[model samples]
Target: MTESFAAARLPVRLTINPRQRQPPSVDLLAWIHRQPEYRPVVRQAGGGGGRPGFSDAVIIAVLAQGLLPGLFNLLQSWVDQQRTEASIRIQTGDTEVELQVSGRTDSARLLAQATEALRAAREPGPDTARELGAGAAREPGADAVD
Candidate 1:
C-alpha cells in the first residue's frame, strides 16, 4: 500500500485591510505571511481583549518587502488616472506609504519587476533598461503631427 502524506499548515489568519476586503494589499499581505521568514503568531490584545492580533515584526517585514512597492505602483496608477490621491500615514504599530504617479505611463511591467525583486530581495537584470526603452518606443511621440 502507498502512504499518503499531507503537508503541515500554519494555524493563523490575518486580515491586512479589513475595510477593503478585496484589495491587492490584502492579497500581497497574505502571500507575504506565507514566506519562510514571516514567522507569524497570534496574540491576545492587551487588557485581555478577545481580539487576536499578529506580531509587529510580521507586519513590518511584510510592509517592507511586499506592501510598499506594490502599493506605490498600484496607487501610482490610481493617482495618475485621478482615481485617488497619495497619502502616507503611520500609526503606533504600522506605517503606510503612498505615491502618486505624476504622468501618463502604464508602468505595469515596472511594478511587476519591482514587486518580484522585493519579494526575493534580489537585484533586477541589466537588460531591464533596454526593455524599458523598447516599451517607451510604443507610445506616441511629442513631435508627432497628424
Candidate 2:
C-alpha cells in the first residue's frame, strides 16, 4: 500500500459505435463487463450527468506502459462473436486513435496501430509533437475493418 512504485493510470475513453444495425453500446458494455479483467473498470459514458459524456464512451484506466492488450483482445473477440461492424475510438488527453473493427479485423495490425499511437501520445515523435502543440488529434485511421 505504497505510492512510490504504483503505476500511474490515465483514463482513456473508448467509444463503441455499431456501424450497421447491430446493437447499442449498452449491450457492448455488458459484454465487456462480463470479462473478468475488465468487469470492474468498465463504466458508463455519462456519469453524474456530465456534459460530453452523452455518447457510447466507456472509460478504462490505463497505464502509460503495457497499453492494455487484453482490452484490444476482448474487442476483437467481441467483433468475431457478433459478426458485426463497429468502431472503437480510443482517446486520452488531446491524442486519439479510431479503429474500425469487425469479424474480419486484423487484430494484430490494429493492436500495433493503437500501440504506436498511444506511445506517440506518451512520447510524441517530432511530427506528433508539433501536432499536439497545434491541438489536433491523430487521424491515422479511416482505418477500416473491411
Candidate 3:
C-alpha cells in the first residue's frame, strides 16, 4: 500500500521596480534560477493577465532549502545596484511575512529579523501539557494557586 503525503512548499513572492528605463531582463531571471535553492517563475508586468505597470516584473519561487542569511544579503546587494524598490513576501503554510527594501532601509537588519522569524517558526516550544502532567503527578493541587 502506498500512502500519499503533501510536500512542504515555501512560496516566495518578489516584486521589483527598476529605477532605469529598462525593465527586468531575462538575464536576471536566469541568475535567480541559478541559485541553489531557488526555483523561479518569472512574469512580466501585465503579461500574465495582470494590470500594466504594476511592477517591472515578479518572480515567484519555491525555496528548496531552509532560509539562509547569505541569500538575503545577495538579494539586497542586487536590488541596491539596480536602484530597484523590492519587496519580498515569504509564505509557509498559514504564516506569511514580508520585507521591503528601499534606498534607506538597512538590509542586514532586515535579514536578521527574517532569520529570527524563521527560527521561531521552526523551533518547537516548551511542552506545557507535559509540564502540567508532571506537576499533577507529583501533587494533586501542585499547580493550583491558593
Candidate 4:
C-alpha cells in the first residue's frame, strides 16, 4: 500500500504573503521556480489575488517525484530568505494539514512539527494521535509557528 501510495501524486498549495510593511521588490514566484529542486515539481497556480496593501500569491504544485520533507524545507528556506510569511497546506481527501510560518518564526522547529504531524496522519493507528500529541510536546518551537 505504501509503495502504491508513493507512486500517486500529491497536490500541495503554498500561499505566500509578502511582508506587510515592505513587500519584496523581487519576483518571488520566478525565484521559487528557478530553484534547482523546485523547478521540476512546482509551478505558480494562478495570478496573485489581494488588495493593494495586502499582496498575496498562491502556488499549486503536484508532487509526483519528491518527499514532502524536502519540499517543506525548500519552502521554509525560500520564505526565510525573503523575510516573509507562508503557509504550506497538503490536502489528501478531506484531511488537510498545514504548516504556517511568519517572519519571526523558527523554521526548523516548525518544519519538524509539521513533518511529524503529516507522518502521523498518513499512518493512522491506535497510537497515532497520541504520538502526534507527544511529538508536539517535545517541540518547543511548534507553538511559535502556528
Worst 10 residues of 3 by lDDT: 1-10
lDDT of prediction 2:
0.57
Best to worst by TM-score, what's the order? 2, 4, 3, 1
Candidate 2 all-Cα RMSD:
6.2
Q: Itemize residue pairs with steric clashes in candidate 3.
A: none
Error of 1 at 75 (Å): 2.0
Off by over 4 Å in 2: 1-11, 20-26, 47-67, 124-146
lDDT of 1 by residue, 1-146 (tens): 22111101212122222112123333333444444345343222233222233122222222332233444454344444443222222111221221112334334543443333222222245645434433333234311222
Q: What is each predicted model's overall lDDT from 0 to 1?
A: 0.31, 0.57, 0.47, 0.57
- Residue 36 C-alpha lDDT in model 2: 72
lDDT of 3 by residue, 104-139 (tens): 546566655554444344446654433333233234
- Assess candidate 4 and give its TM-score to the true structure: 0.60
Predicted structure 1: lDDT: 0.31
All candidates: CA RMSD in angstroms? 14.6, 6.2, 14.1, 5.3
TM-score of each: 0.22, 0.60, 0.51, 0.60
Backbone atom clashes (below 3 Å) for every candidate: 0, 0, 0, 0
The local lDDT score (0 to 100) that residue 37 gets in candidate 2 is 65
Q: For candidate 1, which ten residues in a row score worst on lDDT?
A: 3-12
How many clashing residue pairs are found in candidate 3? Answer: 0
Best by TM-score: 2
